[model samples]
Target: MPQEFSRTERVADYLQQELAKLLLHSVRDPRAEFVNITAVDVSRDLRYAKVYYTKLGVESAEAATDVTRVLDKAAGFLRTEVAKGSSLRTVPKLTFKFDESVGRGRHMEDLLGRARASDALRGNEAEADDS
Candidate 1:
């Protein structure tokens, strides 16, 4: 029988959970205080992992860049911390990326709200025309 989850997927899940905890309670940088680990993608060879994160209440480009910089600067420390909790032979290189999907989702919601309002107005106009 085929395995339920591939090794890479399992590793990604482990990294995601552990990283979330470490970022929340271990990392002391103020800039990383509100960082949320959105997802973790591990390569097939497990040589590198892309860590996606987004800062709570921070959507500006500069703020995103700042968080990314801080995380990247602390990558080595984070890797070591992860190593302490894992049985993997080698910890994958960490790369921090600011996840923009949250911001994009917000923007999409705003657009959808406007569209709904526009449709409502048109509906009212049509009702008035029928009267």
Candidate 2:
């Protein structure tokens, strides 16, 4: 007997393929602005998937809701698209989710820059004290 494929892996692959198509062809979301699918996580049973996406252009909290609503509405279409794209027997449901990792990483970089500036200032002060 062939080993069964895990639900999580199946769901991840489905989401990546379907969302890419929707972004390229089907979706007509007004709030769309260079959205990138960063990652995806699927539950054990393949019922729901948490999609991680980031916006490259201007992004706002209100825009996020519109994007999500469009994605939710297009889930069925996405499922069909995924089925067509993959060789799997089943495709898990798609769920659009905002991934904050991109934002968090940006925030951390800002903090690091500040810390570096502060360290440089202190080093200058130490040099002045020695003089």
Highest TM-score among the candidates is held by which one? Answer: 1
TM-score, structure 1 vs. true: 0.95
lDDT of 2 by residue, 26-93 (tens): 76766664777878888787667777676765244454777777667777887787778777667767
RMSD of each: 1.1, 3.2
Q: Can you give the lDDT of residue 77 in candidate 1? A: 93
lDDT of 1 by residue, 1-131 (tens): 99999999999999999999998888999988988888999999999999998888987666689788899999999999999989999899999898888998999999999999999999999999999
Candidate 2 residue spans exceeding 4 A from truth: 1-7, 58-63
Q: Write down the TM-score of every candidate.
A: 0.95, 0.80
| Candidate 1, residue 116: lDDT | 100
Return the lDDT, model 2, position 116.
100
- Candidate 2 similarity to native, TM-score: 0.80
